[model samples]
Target: MKVPKRVYEGLEAVRSSGRTNMLIVSDVLRCARSMGYPETAQWIEDNRNPYWEGIFQGFSPSD
Candidate 1:
């Protein structure tokens, strides 16, 4: 899926920082929401593994 430049860059940064999978997902969702990419945010939410609840824990995107 294609994401906004900032969201892509943010994910890259999160990866480069050696964040865990959950942290990476959280950051990407946060970026997508802050940038008005609700579809992207929802896609991430929908596509994520059900077992990884921590990935989206406490995150409620306004999108």
Candidate 2:
């Protein structure tokens, strides 16, 4: 799924600020709901496998 730039930016912002996985997911879900994208929020909530991983793994700090 193609993520909107705003959503990507929001998640990136959260990560850059050192937010945890839970907070990042919460941010995404809240953003999606407030932006009238319940499907995206629900998809995030429902998909356990690679859900949080997919959202956050890309932003993991590299050593």
Candidate 3:
């Protein structure tokens, strides 16, 4: 997917933090499996943020 510059930068930061990208990816996929992130993505996307946090934000999508 074509993501924002800040998102790419954040992913770099996360990777540099000693956490494998797979770890984060797994978390997001796990959450996505239980409940899709379309709602959160839409909510956050609707209100654009200068900084884009990664997929997992501690709160999974309920619906």
Candidate 4:
């Protein structure tokens, strides 16, 4: 599944902000799912950090 460049870039920006939490990540994933980007959502879910802060890093389509 191919994710749009804008969507991928937005996700990367959010992940790089250094202020994300699980709730924010969940909201992002939910939005992705709702916007017909299940693969992107799943990619986010798979790559999110396990810690409470900095919920995501190294956002990439090949990860």
Number of the top-ranking candidate, with lDDT as the measure: 2
lDDT of each: 0.51, 0.55, 0.38, 0.53
RMSD of candidate 1 to the truth, in angstroms, is 9.2
Model 2 lDDT tens row, 1-63? 334454445445544555355445777677666656566567567764555565545433222
Write down the RMSD of all candidates, one decimal each.
9.2, 6.6, 11.3, 6.5
Q: Write the per-residue lDDT of candidate 1 for residues 1-63, one digit (tens) a residue.
A: 344454444444444455345346676677656656666567567757631452344322222
Q: How does candidate 3 fare on TM-score?
A: 0.32
RMSD (CA, Å), candidate 2 to true, equals 6.6
lDDT of 3: 0.38
Worst 10 residues of 1 by lDDT: 54-63
The TM-score, computed over Cα atoms with residue i paired to residue i, of candidate 1 is 0.41
Which 10-residue span in candidate 4 carries the lowest summed lDDT?
50-59
lDDT per residue as tens, model 3, 1-63: 335444344444444455354345544334433343344333334434322343334222222
Better of 3 and 4 by lDDT: 4
* lDDT, candidate 4, 3-58, per-residue tens: 35654655555445544543676777766665566765776667554322333333
Candidate 1 regions exceeding 4 Å error are: 1-23, 49-63
Candidate 4 runs further than 4 Å off: 1-23, 50-63
Better of 1 and 3 by TM-score: 1
For each candidate, what TM-score against the reference? Answer: 0.41, 0.46, 0.32, 0.45
Clashes of 3: 0
Off-target runs (Cα >4 Å) in candidate 3 are 21-63
